[model samples]
Target: MKLAFDRGRRTRAATWVSLGLTFAVALVVELTFADSSKADSPLDSKGDQGNSQVERGRYLARAGNCVSCHTSPGGPAFAGGLALNTPFGKLYSTNITPDPETGIGKWTEEQFARAVREGVRPDGAHLYPAFPYTAYTKLSDEDVSALFAYMKVVKPVSFTPPENEMGFPANQRWALGMWKMLFFDEGRFLADSSQSEEWNRGAYLVEGLGHCSACHSPRNFMGAEQASMAMTGGEYTDKVPSGEIRTWSAPNLTDVPNGLGSWPMEEVAAYLRTGRNGFTETHGPMNEVILNSTRHLSEGDVRAMAVYLKSLPGNVGNIGKAASAQVIEDGETLYNVNCGTCHQPTGLGALSEQAGAKLVGNPLVQASNPASLINVILYGPHLAKLPGPKRWKDMPEFGSKLSDDEVAAIASYVRSAWGNVGGAVTQEQVAKQR
Candidate 1:
């Protein structure tokens, strides 16, 4: 009986040992294969790469809107000194140059792909979502290759930007790995066979590579976008000193009653490419996007984005239009009293381009999103270093000049009379902002 009991104990011990060994082996396999840092570069010289590859890379850069994030204010394009503000803290943009020390210059194509597709740098660091790899995860392997190809040729900037500023519990960088475990799924885009090539291209640009929704979409308390309300305007502020109060909201993009619904596709494309539509010149965060990224895109690419925006399928209420009887009467009276000297009764404020400001079809008039209009009304934007003060977006601040009621009245009239959605505005909302 003693011998039998000893034999049975040995068998149980053997079973436990085998199970542990199996688990260890399985973990090794999973970790090795699921390693996301494999986006290293293919060892090809700039001169060795095909001309088409380089050209395509340039196109992809524009489509992905890389410059918008990397470029510094009053600095070289893609030179990488921009600061991004988040609820957790402020994070600066990094250099994407070929510089060996300061940039991704030495990373192989595989390493670069991992950074773009998986938000893990070649050095095994997790990138902040402010880099927008959430949308980039959908980028095709071929396009990711081309983007790396283009990045390899650019002049490398040697300066590393500032470190992230966050309060305790938020400053922990490794915590992002857990965040990724919850949010990221590195996968390629699956096209719907029924859609036109144009539509597919548009979807790629808007949802996958361009990441327009990062700024345009509203976020929950967790900082993740509310996908259902994608691009439908929300709160934002510039990431500069004390980060200028972004009391001026981002307007909704698909609220037809409030956003680009009344505008035509051609105009949208034109605006994206040139930073101007008959109604308004791009300003606020949009101005940076245009000047850095969209303006560099191909006409075809711009058209594709326009088409996608027009096809959003969901609609929100317009918050810019204010055409009620009281609002319009007050607006016209205010315009004639304060603005008639320069702008005509038609509200087609003309542009001098070389001289003073114009008040014409500024998106404020028909803004479906209230942020742009409210910003201009409350804070008044500056002309900055641009060539002309003649732009309509360069309006002076009227926060001190107009009462909350008056500002609401003028904004209401402008939004409604110009074929706007006629959304109502309240004096209380304006006062709250002030």
Candidate 2:
């Protein structure tokens, strides 16, 4: 009986030993596969390959103009607190630094990608469309991974942005899911087989990361971009250095008289690179874009964007109407007194000191919306001092000097004179700009 009991105990011990061995082998196999998967992941492997991936990501970030929205004035880079004023309400940008508590430090690559492409948070909350995730959703996985890798290494800042000041339905984040269902098309860019490689690359950059249409295309009442008017021009409100909210027009990008049709591809590329071409200089929000984004891009990329912009079909849909002969004559007189010295009497513009942009064929002058022209007249050009010969002289602000009627008249004169196709500017429009 004693021998039988001992044998039973040994048999049970053997079974226990067998179970332990099986568990150990299974753990080893699981760990091996896990390590292999990590190594295989582009996010992990490319991130491990030093600064190359990070640098690429940085370039992509610039291309996306991330810093402009993420960083507020006088704030640390990428440490978000910028106030973005939408029609609904004011929304503050969130910190994107690597801070674990306030920023995206704890987010995984998958979470980051999902946030960017799907516009959903790690906690499954929907992001507002103001974040431009609708356009970002077209980002390729590789680019998304690169961006994540770059963000992971950014100097973590322990800062929390102010909460969004949205009212009613706009404040409700859940409604974004329905918004996405209606307007957001979540997918990657598919290169056109018929287009050239450069064209395809341009299309990808312009339509995807650039998100040009977000500003250049008018939005519906629901804040979704109007598909019918893709890039014919749109209006946005900008808060200038002085705590004043100003409305500016993003001009047409389509190949039309009011758009980039008159601009040579090289001129467009040059303008993007240096913020000034032979015709006009970058002002307002475009200053920020050039200073923070396009100036940092590679020549090839800038040229690609120009190519894409130049290729867009023209759609000049009732942008402006003709001014009266008396209004044009009065405007001409104002232009001669106020603007003609810099911009020649013929509107060819002088290249000498105090140079004015050629008003005759200028796209801004011919733009459908005269808000920008009016704003320029009101506030003067808030031009960025880019690296190049300072061809444009500082025009003193006429806001305190010129009446709304006078500003409107001057704008009307330029838009109608020299065969400029831009519509007339009203005193009411000028008053609103003020």
Candidate 3:
């Protein structure tokens, strides 16, 4: 009886000690992050206000793809109203324009910096990860200041975004502080001394302002990107402005067979700059990326990005087998009859923007999955409406005209033919994407 009592007492004491330790840790973290609110800006004393600062900010803003998320279609630039669909609920972007009433105009420089890097609002509320502050946290003070300068100079429109539609506990903004405690690592870009300046620059742009991993890397149920599989590609589904549901497979960016390994740096740079290379064309979300962000960048920056991407460690994923002899034969027949005139008998379509787009050795064609290929075949590009040079002509949707088998056959043929070696796609795969 005495021993049992002593054991029970020990257990209770241990429990109390654990609770105390947890509270102490929580207090330390809260104090650490809250200190960001009072953080000083090195640029505070510079007093560097001029067109050059604004212009530098403009470049940084473009690199960050600020307008794409912050602005709605037909709305004034940066007057945020875009609805971002997440597992929790639809979250609308807040206006970052300089309007005193509706936007960040009232925010002090310190307030803005804290929001950008620490994901904390001026009111001490936590922001959702949908804002991509996880990646933005790596931004340097200079770039952050430049971004602020540019935003302040933009024409501020008087409009407030609608409230986010988060369900239940997710709506509790305080909980996001816990989420940050678990995942957020507040820091600036640390250049690898071993790499060249260009490589480091590219790494900074891709990992920080570009936030490429947000879409390319697979995410957990909670939506935090998997660090282990960074830039290896993943699945993304979204509802378009037209209310059509669309899904895309962001291809791997590594230098593996499943990625951009075969493509030259020039091809990569061209694709970024113009939305089209000789090999493949950008459509869907990538089109918006090029139109709004990469296309506006200088040639040197674009080249540097390509250099960095091509240097990532390769990660080869589950690759399917080549189509059977019978499947290829049927696909060849269908291709000749339905797809040949445009894509050509050789599978190398014309280079002219008005003509058919190149398909042979196209990276999208060679992706591990056939979702993107099937999507374009069924829906014909589902192109985003944005201002840019029209680099590729939109193709007609053959979803209704061609049966699933025929579509699969043609896709298989494209994957296997013209020096392309991507594995054959299945009918079930085609049906699901459809």
Candidate 4:
């Protein structure tokens, strides 16, 4: 009885100590993040703040790719109607406009910065991970301030965002406090002495304001990123704006032999500048990036990004497997039987008579999974929506005719055949989209 009592007492003491530590840490963090001072900016002066503020805001929006989540296709900018699907549930984006109630009209710079960098809203509600604060945490205070300044001057949106479609347990915003504790780190880019100025700048953009990690990083079971394996992506899923099912396997961005290491700098720049490279095309999440974020960047910035990505060290020793025989064989046979008409045996589809796309050299063949290939086969890629590419390959939707397994097989075949190097597509992957 005495020993049991002592053990219970020890456990209670430990709990108290843990709670005390958490409180102290939280206080330190809150104080450190607090801005002790600020000058009267143009927004504080109570007016339009001039063309410069608006233009600066536009740049900040572009840098952050605000349109990616906030603006639905053919919808008003920052309207907050986009619905993001996640493993836990669906999260609807909020209006960032300056409307007094529905929009951010009442939000101070502090509120905006906290939302952007810390994933907390004006009312102190936690935001869904879809907001990508993990990457935004690295944004400089000055940039955050500039972004808030810009949003304030924009047209106010009177619209209220749709409710988050999450169910019970997952809908609890307080859970994110635990999530943030595990994943969130408040820090800025620290330049390495060994790298060049251009490389460092690229690193800052890709790792910071751009939130490339949102797409590229693999998430833990709790939806936190496994940071050690930074850009070697795992499974990610979504639906395109057109209501066709879409999923993604954010490919490894590190400079492994089969990863970004194979691509030349010019090819990387071309893909970033335009939507297409002779080797592959961007779709799904990357399509948003090209249409909104990357393509709009300066050529110098694009090249710098390419350089920085290329300069990354080879992957850690642990790597996934090559395509299996069963997967490869079934996939190849299906492609030949069904896909030969358009994509052909070589994986080269007739994108256009003069402008053709090669499947062997294509990025789709080398993606981390069969999601893009399956998506393209189900719903043709929309490469022509932007300025970069005039011509694109459009495969007819095979959803009605093809079984999920058949689609998986074909994707698996394409990935393994014709010098392509990526993981095999299981029926499980195909089933997730269907």
Candidate 5:
């Protein structure tokens, strides 16, 4: 009986050992195949990889506005050094050129895709949110591979930007893993079956690569955009041409009183392509968008974006009430004195390129919130430097010449004049912005 019990114990031990070996072998095989599968994706498969791929990638890069953030003012394209200001501190953009030591020349295709889509470096460090990989995560594997192919062939420059400056916990890159866990979702875009093909394409670009909400959507104290109030409006800092940093608010883009609710889709497309559409001229960051990105896009894409944007519902209760009679009369006089020569007495701006923007039926002039109008009047337009035909003439700044009350009057007049029902501008608002 003792001998039989000893044999039973040994047999059980042998069974357990066999099960452990099988599990270990299975894990090894799974890990090996997983890595190999990623490397051998259809997107990474060898094919006609030459001029066409590079050209397509170039278009995609332009659509993504890679150069705007990556290229510093007066710096070599893609060499990087652009300072991105955050509430905590400044973070410098990285060089994306093909330089072996400085740029991404040594990275494998899989590594490049991982960085673009997953915000993870080859060494497995989490990238800061400033990289916009949250939006890029929706990019398809094929598009990422194409971008990688294009980046690999770009003019390589041996340059490194300064290290990012953040205080304490904000500077720790490892902390981003937690941030991603909360906010980031890793996946490619899926076309909505319910939407039209054009709408779907536009939605993909806007929600993913364009990341328009980064600036347009309000953020909480944690720096995450408020998805609930998307495209409603947000305030950001912009450097004026005179080197002074000014607080500028991106106006609501939704179909509401203060937003793009009244704008025609065609006009929106025209504005994106040319920076002007007889309503308002693009300035500041938007100028850069037109110069570096949107202007280069196909007309179809621009139309698609316009269509998608126009479909958004605006805030119903956000509309401003009409101004008092005395305020309107006071504003008209100011408009006549300061703006009549350029914009004409009737508020129908001159047709000449050197003249002022048209006020009649102009969306910017009729916006419920007059922040953009005040900004343009105070700081003037900063024309984007681009290699193309001129879009719009520059406007002069009135900050030095006009008092806060006077600027408010002119803005109020424009908003209320010529069948426009936009509300009055306030001196207090003007003073705060100044």
Candidate 6:
């Protein structure tokens, strides 16, 4: 996530001119064939004055987790200025507050709907996929109108975000049209007739506003999500409080031995609601998602999401290899000396005391990627303080104490022992995380 603009600009001017002409034609083609239908009628006629519609919109915004990306640290909510670092470039989120000059105050409902569903700005500029409009495009018309209504009423803030620092070709906004043609599919969520009403509701939320796949699914060279491998896990970087960029793995959501196959529906619901199940607790980015989004959802909606997630078929094709026996043995020795007091020799964990999480049958320990497992061993879990009586102390950081080989040994041991099937950790992987 280095700033592309900081790189030396030595390219010939002809290269820019050639790319500009190509993109201009692509933009014209995209706009020519784009759907021109007007937005549907509002769900309610009372406009923003309708308390019920506004309230529903407020809840939907929570489901969308809008503020998490829109607001900068210590800044007004929705007065966006968050820097989103991606492989292609850095993009700053735009202010969504109702400020006429700097936010969405002057945007009409049709303009808002088009932006959310079509990835097109009011002035006809193509928005980068980093906005997750690909998933938002699946939102129902009613939900779109409700969201617009809610946004219209938020307090206005007159802050403008910093300009995006994308590299030469990516800095070309019109190039996004060609990217869309290759991967984007604009449409609303279609309910399955064979599925239960609760299941359908869950699918709508997860596929549309929740935008779960945007994080959970792996992306290709062009940064589009791989449709065939949806939710088998993905990796992304987040800026830690220490200002260092850290890579994190989003575990597979499918029903598999290494994923959620072993998790009960109730456990999934509990985790979403409270950020912890009896077996494991959330840390890092997931903590923010639960705190800002899922925890605020209704009980029925939570259960529905759990049901849908549990129904996903496991991807058996991508299972990892077991760690070497010698590595596991060394790891076990380290675990006994440093971890057994809290985790116990059996790996059952002391949930009542909250000293450690259950490693046996833990989805994270058995994830396809071992990045998060290694991260925890190196940095300790930066577990957020929730509203409850304190039962255990925070896990200490081992980064300063453990050698790269020793850390890899411990990670390899947990990932392969106790019937876990995740891949072994290499000293090289440990060094990268450090």
Better of 4 and 6 by lDDT: 6
Q: Kindly list the per-residue Cα lDDT of model 1 for residues 160-232, writing each as its tens digit.
A: 8777575544555565676567556678888879877887888889888777766566665445666777777
Encode model 5's per-residue lDDT on 1-434: one tens digit a residue: 44545787886555434322221111100000010001111222233445788778877888888877777666677787877665446677789887899999899999999999899998999876667787889999888887888777777778999987766545667756765776678999999899899998888778887877766766654456667888876556656555655556566788765567657889889888877775666666577677667888899999988888888777432337777788888888988888888788887776576667767766555554567678778887665544445543567888999999889888887887877656788999798668
Model 5: weakest 10-residue lDDT segment is: 28-37
Clashes of each: 19, 1, 0, 3, 0, 0
lDDT of candidate 5? Answer: 0.70
Clashing pairs in 4: 98-105, 280-363, 331-409
Tens-digit lDDT track for model 4 on 86-115? 433556777887778898888888888888
Model 5 — TM-score against the truth? 0.79
The residue ranges of model 6 lying beyond 4 angstroms of the native Cα positions read 1-50, 390-393
Give per-model TM-scores.
0.74, 0.87, 0.81, 0.80, 0.79, 0.87
- Give the Cα lDDT of each candidate: 0.63, 0.75, 0.73, 0.66, 0.70, 0.76
Where does the lowest 10-residue lDDT sum fall in candidate 2? 28-37
lDDT of 2 by residue, 203-280 (tens): 888898988887788766556777888998776776443336766677888888778878899999998888888888
User: lDDT: which is higher, 1 or 2?
Assistant: 2
The residue ranges of model 2 lying beyond 4 angstroms of the native Cα positions read 1-49, 240-243
> What CA RMSD would you report for each candidate?
12.9, 18.6, 9.6, 8.4, 15.2, 8.6
lDDT of 3: 0.73
> TM-score winner among the candidates?
6
User: Which residue pairs clash within candidate 3?
Assistant: none
lDDT-sorted candidate list, best first: 6, 2, 3, 5, 4, 1
After TM-score superposition, the amount by which residue 130's alpha carbon in candidate 3 deviates from its true location, in angstroms, is 1.4
